[model samples]
Target: MKRPAPRTATTRHVTQINRTAILDVLREHGPLSRRDIQQRTGLGSATIERLCSALMEEGAVEAAGQVRQSVGRPSTLLRFASSARAIMAVDVTEYTARGRLVDLGGSTLYEESHTFALEGQDAGAARIDGLLGLVDRLASPETGVTAPIVAVGITVPGIVHEGVVTKAVELDWQEVPLADIVSARSGLPILVENDANATAYGEWHSGALANAHSAVALVLGARLGAGIINEARLHRGHRSAAGEIGFLLTSSASFSRYFTEQGDVDSTLAAQVLPFAAREGLHGKRIGPAFRAMMARCRAGDSEAEQARDEFFDSIALALVATSVVLSPQVIVLAGAFAQYSEESAEQLTRRLVGRIPWVPRIAVSDLGFDAAITGVSALTIEHARSATYLA
Candidate 1:
């Protein structure tokens, strides 16, 4: 399908709309020329030029450089200022971690991560303090940043209700005021999201499904989670657990159980999957080395590891296939640990998925790898920061 060029208009109301549209273009694809903006947005050349002049005057954007085409005169390119402002992106998931300083245009400046053991109430408190420390250090005037963290985007496992995390099954958190604590400590407007939903939103806004109207993301890490986006709004149902697909409980009792039969979840599993978990300041279980070795062997092509991977992914496929039937999204991106396993499983799942749904969403492994959460979280921060422009 052909995308129409941004509509160009001479009216003041249309110019206001174009202001938001121009920003979206630069945000999604930066350092664009006046011509590039006109093409992507379908706006008239004159209107684009006018808006660019006004935005420059308002300090919302700046002229970056001139673009030399293959066989034409250089075109002046405009881009969001790198120093426009910055936001904090905090990803606190069950299997990985990150805290980054991101700019309004979604560029990450600095980030850090490490392992952790977070479970129950006391652990949550400890994790919160640790995350605060990272924020303080990053936001310190000594860091040489152009701006402090004006907004925050955080992702976590389990169900988040308003600011309270009602049920983080993996973290064993119930009715916890997570957002309040983080907001108080950081002194920034905070937007907390379920990890999967955040990832899906990030992928969509980042143009992963550039051609599609909507997409779904299935993140397989320490546990399975899914996120859905249609018409650009996150489908967080009334309870705000819209993407909590982990608790769906496969028929395979073992697959459904979070811990081993012995009731022990090895720290290695935590290390292998959640090595950076603590650094994000999220609270969750910590697996030992034994679990890490097992996961490593699985990724390294060990036969036993292969079998485990196959079994785990096969069950995961069933859930995914089922979801495809319901949502029928344009694509389903597999992220986290499972992305490694998807190359082998995509075919199997596709073959078995025939006749199940009228249309099956294209299944592909996430190309973003471990950085999906961070990228998504960063996107979230930028989205909130630009809300004023969009809403106006």
Candidate 2:
């Protein structure tokens, strides 16, 4: 590989730092006068003006209005030009790929979801084609994007290491160079991340867990996983697989089988629990109905359903407590469909965790919903775009 130097690395780093400081301040605090920016960042007046001028030319900043002063001249207020560039993020799940095109401020400009069924012998290649098709659609003009698309961030359900998806049993993918492939197809920079980790990051960055010192996003969708945050930073673990909490042997459900590629959620939910619920006439279709049925029955004083509810929630709390005891986040956010019953689920887990640990973190429902990965990837791509602002 050859180095592509638009500027010396030292100069580029300092430039990015200065730009990030000004842009971040404007972004976080909204519109501000140059004096306010100077006070906020401690950068000199001349430096601020020069950078602001460059940013305005690059469409990254714009004049908001002028602040009328009691004395002397009026000060011009500048705002971060959130719509200057588009950031596209796609989150790949087991049966669907949900994506969005957002501005620098993380506001959705375009959004679409494609539900796909990948089967047969050539599933992996088909998956890639389908995914790339989605990428193309996201970048299409129907998204109403007039600005340059800086980069695309992808989040997938798997153990993502570097730019490769090491394992995604749901997608039946292993060791796929997803980032390079997407980048090649789109001719743009690509950032790939594990879905759970991305969800945790999204929650921490701008959703339910925002401002918390530490937090964990326990994803209880069709599968079980987690995104861990410690000291306001993601803990990607060895090989960036830090929050694979599904494999923990904390499930209280007695199942005849062991974990397969899908991990414990496979054995616990799809195989053992749902099957039992179906056979026992708890639900006609799936886990959501089944869980609701059980809860309703248990509330109606059905002994069997009550006991079943206790065991199911105990299993979940086991997974949560197992991760919490180690990471010790200040809060744990529940992500996925099961989170719709957040209060009920929180009650179940909270009551079950009694005496299990010294202190129980606050349990919160995910405000980002299913698009957490999209929000998270937006965060990642925003950082990448900022870093490469003038460096590239």
Total clashes in model 1, counting residue pairs 3 or more apart in sequence or in different chains: 16
lDDT of 1 at 210: 45
lDDT per model vs. reference:
0.68, 0.80
Q: lDDT value for candidate 2?
A: 0.80
State the lDDT at 119 in candidate 2.
55
Task: List the candidate 2 regions with Cα displacement exceeding 4 Å.
Answer: 1-9, 68-73, 117-121, 250-271, 276-306, 390-392
RMSD of each: 8.5, 4.8
Instruction: Provide the TM-score for each candidate, comma-separated.
Output: 0.69, 0.84
Q: Which candidate has the top score in TM-score?
A: 2
- Model 1 alpha-carbon drift over 4 Å, by segment: 1-58, 62-82, 94-97, 114-121, 249-311, 389-392
Q: Which residue pairs clash in candidate 2?
A: none
